[model samples]
Target: MPSAFLLIGIPGIENGATWTSLVFCVLYVLAILGNSALLYIIKTEESLHTPMFFFLSLLALNDLAFCSSTVPKTLGIFWMNGGLIDATSCLTQMFFVHCLSVIESGILTAMAYDRFVAICSPLRYSSVLTYSLLRKIALAILLRAIALIFPIPLLVRQLQYCGDNIVLHTYCDHMAVVNVACGDKRVDNVYGLVMSLFVTGFDLLFIGLSYSMILQAIFKMPTKDARQKAVGTCGSHISIIFIAYFSAIFSFLTYRFGQKTIPHSVHILSSNMFILFLPFWNPLVYGVKTKKIRQRVQRILFYNQSTFPPSRH
Candidate 1:
């Protein structure tokens, strides 16, 4: 077994690594600050303690995990040529990246269901998504992600890596690592495909169905203002959903099919962008679209007062 694998970050863009690293560094800092502030605001504001905000907090945390898992080493490779990642560390990173990806899909699905309940079945929203049930849903998301992704790294470990230990991407992506192993990779490939379809396909199907129901309910509302209000409520989540899924699908497709036609730099860069961009964008989208979160964030930054006024006894 190889001791450590080398990550050739953006193979053809070595000359521009300084600029690339700088851009990635700025984005990483922004993603961290944005998600941290989001988590903080959601945590402190009592009024924001609803099921929607609870799921947003989970998304923020997942974004943080997603970026932190890959960006530091990517920066190291880009700026300082530190691409060495040991077998265990690489597997650990791969596990978290893929696992959190699945979790994000699950969270988005849950949020869609939350919206469906709120817009389609308004009377039962609170009763259906009580905190107890919310905790259970969150736990299930975590468990399902782990159950699906845990076998991937194990499969990689079993393969004999007799060839070069250089991975042609920024992080220990499952297929990327498997490609470097000198063993039959059909099992790994099939499992990855099955898991991807099961997670992404399944989650997207439900999300689509939920939004279909939500749109149906919105149009049935008595007035245009009511329909607009319903859409307004879901705008931030829809923006986030698009950002997360679109970038992910683009990257996944490019890796699986565009390998021959797409430039290596494009592949590596897009993958990094997918991992980094969503975290940075999540807080911005929510803060700008969600009225309460926006006001609370503004107060935190521009004023020294608490997010909400204190309660009188």
Candidate 2:
């Protein structure tokens, strides 16, 4: 039983279609297993013990969280008629969403910094990103995510809603919930916009700059193979980054910039885009590009079999 109730167009607790519910079930299954596999791969592979992989594993963890925060509820809503979530459950969903959003933004920023250090000061890469230092940086990202997100949830919890409980979206969101409040919402809206633009916008600029330096480094390299490999490593990251940012930007625009004429379904679509695209793409992106991850996964599987032999006679 969820504490928060959604005020969606389906009216009170209407049961969604069977196929839609099934689709969500399938997606949730894949999302959990995919991210779990990524965690295992990074942990098992000693060779994959690099700054890039470190950031990636964190990103994977966040993706798992990002999906976990909403997918379960969304599926629940679809599976049950008149899916009724309690107020506290709604708040929890919003809190986790904010937390994961903060973390993903921080992880992207750290990844850009990692690329900057790797490209701009190649000589100091090892010393700058030593294992202990990596742990601290990761902890910093986690702390920053929690710190940035805590305020939004706190603010939301303070408000009193006066019966406009039909949340247009399937899951709880900061703005969506805040919009239902009888209290003044302008301040919350402003805070939301500032938070959104600052974190995502800032990360995008730094990522762009990182690629600029990386491109220069590639051109100055003496051999084609070196350049090719460098570009290869960057390709998947660039693709994933583009997709993640695009979905985020689209959703942000709809919530902050778009007019009422845009309709509820459009908003739902944008939110869905943000929810599904990154989780599905991110694991594939890093898992495919990173060599150590592959090797480690292989070892994890091999060792698992070795340790637990089949019951054959």
Candidate 3:
């Protein structure tokens, strides 16, 4: 087995590694703080203990896991010039990164279903997404992600890497690692394509369908106020889904098909953005858009003020 792999951080901007490191560091900090705060607020707030908030909490955890999978090592290379990763370590990182991504996609699908139930059958929403059912959904998402991704490291381990072991991206990814292997990687590529199509692609399709039904239901509402309220509830989720999937799909397609035409820097930056942007912004989007979360976050941040409001007596 190859002992270690080198990560070639941004090709052309090699001299600007410090600047790149600083920017990523800031984003990582924001992601960590934002997700942590969201989790804390969700866990502590009694009124936000429903299925929707429960799923949002899971999303916050996923965002944390997803960003943590790669950013630290990426920062290690950019900040401290530690770029080499052992074969086993590289495989571990790739496994978690891909697994968390798949899990997040599944969670997004579940969230879409939650919205569907809420808007389509308000009376049945609680019964449909009870705590027990939510637990099962979460467990199924985890199991499916693990089962689908379990083959990746095993398949990758069988490859021969006689060529330069330099990964041209910021992190250790399946494609980036596979591209370096000297052996026939057609199976690996095919498996990846199949997984993407069956898993993430299916989730995106279902989310789209869910939203279509949601819109149809909202339009049928008798009053504009009711329609706006329904739309408002889904707005944050829609924003997050768009940011997450659009960036992810864009990066995936660009890596697979735009290597020749797209600028190297653009590809590298977009790939990083795909992994980092959603995690960094998801909490902010929900915290600002969801009134309950925003209020709880405010209370958490300014406990003293909330504890003792200005004297009106």
Candidate 4:
């Protein structure tokens, strides 16, 4: 085990530290505030007590946890030059970051399935997605994420870190950390590739299938209003799914294959941006597109408007 690992923050852009830190700080603030407000509204609003909103609440919490794992440490590195992370802390960070990612993917898949069921068999949707079933789904998502990535830290821990302990990325990425270790990393590499493919690829494939089924069901509806209503219900979720997956996929591709074409700092920055952008934008996307959430947010922000002197009646 290494004493501490140093994170090289945004290599080749040393002068942009303050600017980078500012952007990160802003994103973190927005992500925290937005996710918290969404969670609060969902909890308090009886209208949002359905399975869709319940799944959304879980996603908000996951986004918060996901960003929490990386952004704070990243800020520490950029602002205070607090780059050196102990092995235990680094592994812990790695675990949660990847775990939350898997959880997010699973949640997205579950949401897609929810949409599919709602559209395809509206009559059975309520009975099919009971609270008990949702609990089981949540548990299964958590367990699957944990079980798949549980070996990552353990595998990395067995390797010796005699070489340069400096990590190029802002946070303790599993691959970056493993690459620096001084032992056989074939298992780690293979496992990582498999996990990445399975989690993202599998979830994405299912999401696509679910939506395809959903669209077919929507098209079969007799009226334009019915089709539009069905599509509208899925609009926010589809946006979130695309944004989150796009970022994650871009980051993954860049890290795995963009070293030659993409500038190192550019790759690093984009990777961090993906981590921050998803959580930061998720609430805004949902709040704007989901009419009920939008209305509730408006009411909460303008709680006193109804009592104003506009009632000159």
Candidate 5:
């Protein structure tokens, strides 16, 4: 049934050739390959098994699952008039999308805490961020995400979608799907927003606050290299986080408060951009910021060079 579900929309209305469809295809490939590679690098490199990279692995996994669920369906709809997505498939997408989203936000907050202790309380960093603690945190994250999102889609199942299931966007997104409900979605929206704010929005605030304190701590520390290293480790994360949450907050606010003037194209683009670009940026920015990944990449290149032994000059 999931495979048989139809995505009725503008695409269903008898039209063809959307440039964005191609873009979504490219996005799907990048999301899969990019996140897969990140996971590979982390798994192969034992040194990367720290709490920081552990969370990185979780983030990568979530990205892989999250992107896989939506992009392919969207791409199919783009190429064909309308892709069939059964109600089961739609709810599944809704569940995984929100689940991954919450996990990503939670992991980011945990990483910020990791940074805080690493910088603020270096001597106690290892003890504070023990494997058991991280495992607990991860379990907490998973449980929280599951708890928050599972019901919304189940609630959706109860709604009577008698007609007009034509969603304008590529995939079965939350607001898009919920809008078709015959009953009031106000409770659903409010409840979901509360969870999102606590899980994602508030988490972002905490991460930022942690970084602010870290900045202050760095300034107080003597030695340029220390200051540079501390700040540099965070700059890439800060950049990626800024892009991710800015797009997210923009999309959320526009969906909620900025709907009047927000063009459909703008609304759609902003939402997809975060998931599309942010996932790719996570591994990339971390590779740049962390010396270990750069070293591993260099070694990989060198190993390939040795294997082929470049043509004699």
Candidate 6:
């Protein structure tokens, strides 16, 4: 086994990598700023202390970790030509990249459940989603991700890479790394497929079910205004869910099925976008769609402004 693996980073687009790095740099900065602002707002605003915002805070933190795990190394590979990642570090990155992805999926599912309870069982919302339960859910998400993803790196580590050591993607993606191995990899392939289906398929199924119930409840409301309000409440969550899952599904399918028809650079870009799209858009979606967050953000920006002219003037 080689000591380190080299990442070629967006094959067939080497010359444009610097420009691509600039775009990724901008998006990373935005993701950091947006999610950090979200965390700060949720932390400081007493009124925002509810199960919904609590889940949003967790999402923000996860987005921060998720984007951080891969973007820096991606930037290094693109700008600094530093793509040589030690085998252990490569596995470690692969683990976090996949683990955090599952964690994000779990968080989104929890958010879906929160909305389901809030809309469908409003009276029981407070009792059903206590902070204690939320904490337990958060812990379960962490443990579940660890349990499912831990074996992935171990499986990859067992492989003997007697062939090329260059990873085609920017980061040490699990399948990308596994594909570089020279020997039998049926177990790794099956495991990766099973885990992806289990995590993504399971979470997506629940999210869809939650929304179906939510919609049923909304439609059952007699007053049109009440129904609209209920739908409005779910708009941001729905948008975010769509963004997160669509990018993920697209990337997954493209990698698994479209490898022959799809251009390599397109696949790499889509994969990178899957990692970046949600983090960049989550806060923006919430800040614009959630009234309280929008109001709070406005107040924070214009808190010092006075309606009347200064007496000295």
lDDT of candidate 1 vs native?
Answer: 0.91
Clashes of each: 0, 12, 0, 0, 5, 0
Off by over 4 Å in 4: 304-313
TM-scores for every candidate against the unseen true structure: 0.95, 0.87, 0.95, 0.95, 0.91, 0.96
- The global C-alpha lDDT for each of the candidates, from Candidate 1 onward, is 0.91, 0.76, 0.88, 0.89, 0.77, 0.91
lDDT of 3 by residue, 1-313 (tens): 5788898777887778789888888998999999999888888889999999899899989989898888888888777778888888989988998899999899989999999999999999988898999999999999999999989999999988886789887788889899999889999999988988798678988999999999999999999999999999999899888888887888788888898998877888887877788889988888898999878867766877778758988
Q: After superposition, how far is residue 67 of candidate 5 from its true place, in Å?
A: 0.8
Model 6 pairs whose backbones collide: none
Q: Which candidate leads the pack in TM-score?
A: 6
Model 5's lDDT to the true fold? Answer: 0.77
Task: Return the lDDT, model 2, position 105.
Answer: 75
Taking all chains together, the TM-score of candidate 3 against the true structure is 0.95
- Candidate 4: residue 141 Cα off by (Å): 0.4
- Residue 282 displacement (Å), model 5: 1.4
**Residue 273 lDDT in candidate 1:** 88
Candidate 4 on 95-142: residue-level lDDT in tens?
A: 988888899899999999999999999999999999999999999999
**Model 5: per-residue lDDT, tens digit, 162-185?**
565666666677887777666777
lDDT (10s digit) by residue, model 1, range 1-313: 5999999888887678788899999999999999999999999999999999999999999999999999999988877889999989999999999999999999999999999999988899899999999999999999999999999999999998786899999999998999898889999999998898788889999999999889889989999999999999998888888888888888888878898999978977888888999899888888888899888877777675555588997
Worst 10 residues of 1 by lDDT: 299-308
Per-residue alpha-carbon lDDT of candidate 6 for residues 55-138, written as tens digits (9 for 90 to 100): 999999999999999999999988788999999899999999999999999999999999999999999999999989999999
What is candidate 2's local distance difference test score? 0.76
Our tally of clashes for model 5 stands at 5
Model 2 Cα lDDT, one tens digit per residue, 202-239: 78888888888888888998988977887887787778
Cα deviation at 56, candidate 5, in Å, is: 1.3
The alpha-carbon RMSD values of the candidates against the true structure, listed in the order shown, are 4.3, 3.6, 2.6, 2.3, 2.8, 1.9
